[model samples]
Target chain A: MWRGLQVREQSLLSLLLPGLRSRGPRLQCQAAIRALTGGPGPGPGGLRGELDRFGGITVRLGQLRSADSVDPATFRTWLQGKCEQWRAEGRIAVWLHVPIFQSQFISPAASLGLRFHHAESDASLMTLWLGEGPSRLPGYATHQVGVAGQCPSFAQSNNFFVLFSGLIIQTKNAWKFPGGLSEPGEDIGDTATREVLEETGITSEFQALLSIRQQHGRPDAFGKSDLYIVCRLKPLSFRVSFCPHECLRCEWMALAALATAEEATPITRRVASLLLYGHREGFDKVDLTVRELPALHRGLSYKLYHRDLPELYEKMSAMD
Target chain B: MWRGLQVREQSLLSLLLPGLRSRGPRLQCQAAIRALTGGPGPGPGGLRGELDRFGGITVRLGQLRSADSVDPATFRTWLQGKCEQWRAEGRIAVWLHVPIFQSQFISPAASLGLRFHHAESDASLMTLWLGEGPSRLPGYATHQVGVAGQCPSFAQSNNFFVLFSGLIIQTKNAWKFPGGLSEPGEDIGDTATREVLEETGITSEFQALLSIRQQHGRPDAFGKSDLYIVCRLKPLSFRVSFCPHECLRCEWMALAALATAEEATPITRRVASLLLYGHREGFDKVDLTVRELPALHRGLSYKLYHRDLPELYEKMSAMD
Candidate 1:
């Protein structure tokens, strides 16, 4: 029965040939042919793909025989034709797995409306949605969270406060706040405290969220975006038993000196300055406090971090 | 050959029976039995799993016949036995797909050192890494990034600035800055502008990052954590053709009024205050600016967002 439908589609295409002489009309004719056939038919291009569960087509470019050596212009023309064909066939989405070596084709693909979905070390996945309503395709997550703890030193004299710093083994021994990536299911504060203990053997309690730095395209984060949250932590123990595998040195340094020290990372220095400002002024001016709220799901709760609410707004009914 | 190994493991267990009478030594004996057998031996519990590529084990509790009716205490004991058996077998990781209905088991499992990896509507995937060296398992991303555009209205007069807001159809008609989730690989600024245009038919350009609210356990985000960024936007065209499907109404409201409005979401109100502070004082005090920097990969760049540095620190060497 399907084969018979294909034959009928071919006959219809032949009947419409004369009217489709122009380039634009020819493309439209092919689309109509696809509509009649109920899916993409054999095209002039060699690209091949399988029908996905959603009635979409997913092409793995690296698997093609001529993928590595294919001409960009030819690929672009083929993609353009295929997109129209897929759209007419009522396909909901198009997925293209473009390998790293075929990066040259990325620009052309983007120009034709494909957007980056996510990337691995060897390949980047791009997609285009052709469905009627807004695309139902869920986006892959594009960010990783890293938490750092700024542990204030107990030994303080004059008006100066000291902070613990580690000479990290990973970055040419530059001094930085002791921290690490947040493990799955770990809260920001929990991660900060855990990392501080693991890297410098310091026991601390989470005080408040001080600042956040967001960066994209980090190689260490598997090419995903990164969010680094710096939390202020109050120290419970001052002893330093630094992990030799992760840090070259760890010590307490004056906040003012560390803020200006050439050895510290730019983020560290900037955060130090912010900390100084908070110390001189009030912490409420800079801290983003965390609140635990009941989640929509029964028996579960979620953490919300934002600037502390003023007394007037604190009494307002909670927003969902 | 496998049967022979199992028999030998049983014989070994029998030989160690005297010492294994104690609880501590019983676990040790089971571990030894597993080491000799090269896999988990038949245990007293009914729980089962398949070995993954990395010598890990994955169990889908939802697929079990008795999953929906299992007793929490009994399940905990069974899980404890299974964990010991798997750990003895030198399994690298253990994955459990706990259905929402079986949530009572979550606390027990968590007490046994399992952590949440990710969640879907029907179930939450939890994991435990038992092998040496920090768990080689990759963590599932726990965040969804949402970008909202705080468009400064053109109707602003006097010293007070007006902001565009929509009565969101999804949130009890509460007023909110126009926004949506960031598409995979889209910049925060791009998402803000795109969302503003899509929701209000108002063309805008991203100006600066104003504030961020991080909340965990959002159900609409497939049970992932959420990061909501508010971007200050400069409107290009202000004629609002509000999307009826998304908003009940759209209008420009005075910043002062919106800042204290009870109809706005808590986050919206908080951001309004931040924006008002920026307006009265200096935006430099509140805005986190974006900078494009070279990525580790050739021919790629990443955006970094942080507070603008003071003049003294602005000239410092860029930290990787």
Candidate 2:
């Protein structure tokens, strides 16, 4: 009881005397710049706790963990409770800056009209309007898009492109595609091609669409979803350069080798087989209409076209 | 000469009579829907041509191979040739749909006013306003953002998380984080927690942050760049139930075991060591201003935080 009173007394004194809030002597430093919330007047720097701005409180969310009952409903309820508490505190808006990878809370936050405000270098800003009179609430949709390339082997080698981060580092035994996540406003195809080039330093051309897979219920996904697009690409150059920051080395592995490489990811082998050998068994194809021939390959005068697999087969068979 | 003449005659006939272009009968099926570009226009079903909308001709790009020189200047020259050809063909707006992975052409395309047009499910639309008086080409900045989680070991088991996509598929021998790419607008912290939950079905709480890394000159980046944020997370629930579609299984791995695991990525090993043993050798701590804890941790909150290290130190000191 005495400790509780002491805590309350200290808070009361701190609240009444802002200058006396610090337990230690204030250090001499240059004036701190305003946190770019861009609304309301500037405030002091390095001040712990909520900063009142834009008629709301900017919350610094600690690293979030699932509450004991880590289900979707409970998580949402927890988020709702936080909003309610903020509302009761007479805040007009609740601005939360979350890291850009938290997909689980997006939907729940969206439900509360705390939509995406903008993106920083590493985090996304979300704001929930708490004021009563017709606040502007925008609809937002979030998705995890994993962009990877089927860096196919050259026609002669029949090998697919792969990169080894190194035998001494994180991916010692595993080989990965020169692909990663698509950036904001970047095309998925561009992601695949860039990743391959970045990892292999081999400029590749995007070819046919191989397959797109969507899976949900990932732990990191927070019950959201992920979309992965795998493209069939042809290597135009055989340069073996690579960015050391991203990978240690690049190689053109035979299809047979990739299929059996103990270090290859499950998805990599499947893609090599599908793109190189035309083995599209378990996955469905997305029918795309393209200029009968690719722009670079237009010299061959391949007529532009689009067709389902069955129709395409029929046309070839008819010629035969 | 007879065969060549006959082929020429057939081509001439087909060019003149568009209806008779197909050598075989056209497939009698319901008219196909336009590819779900989520834009204006009802195009002819399965017509092998660019979709005409927004006063532009959507281009189908081919698998690009760099010529022997394989420089950006050369690639740009080749692209310029294609653009010139299209200009001659009277295309006003050249709408090229580059995949997200096509980093090689990004700078060159951006320079040609083939800026970001819009996005579809799998690709980004770049519009090169070739026709008309001063077409509005908006500049777009593209980045590949990767969110990884550093799931810290709980008190009982200094066991970091390691997920297996299963023993059968491509990820047969590999272990991965409970994290992947963050969905659009998702917070990086949320990404760490959510991914852990999605892959492991263990609800984790965001703890202190670990690190943020930015890298440039990635091959797939095509001179663009990527930002990766690795977070320190605390698992709330240990019961890990994962979706079969996402992973084979997840296990809590001891820090020491992970440091030596051949398949573990170098980054993963370093992270495990740092989190478990405060191993800060040969790497700089990314300056992330979260709670002052990390900065203090830099200055021996490091000592206050770890009991094992202290006990070991005390034993060594006593021996001394």
TM-score per candidate: 0.56, 0.28
Tell me candidate 2's fraction of native contacts, as a decimal between 0 and 1. Answer: 0.02
Each model's chain A TM-score = 0.59, 0.44
Largest DockQ belongs to which candidate?
A: 1
Query: Per-residue error at B129 for model 2, in Å?
Result: 36
Question: Against the correct fold, how does model 2 do in TM-score?
Answer: 0.28
Error of 2 at A61 (Å): 21
Docking class of 2: incorrect
In model 2 chain B, which range of ten residues has the least summed lDDT?
Answer: B300-309
Tens-digit lDDT track for model 2 on B117-183? 4432223455677776886433233444555665555434434444311111113445556566556
The residue-by-residue lDDT of candidate 1 on A231-283, one tens digit each, is: 88888887779888678887777667677777776667667766666665666
lDDT agreement of model 2 with the native:
0.45
Which pairs of residues have clashing backbones in candidate 1?
Answer: none
Error of 1 at B36 (Å): 19
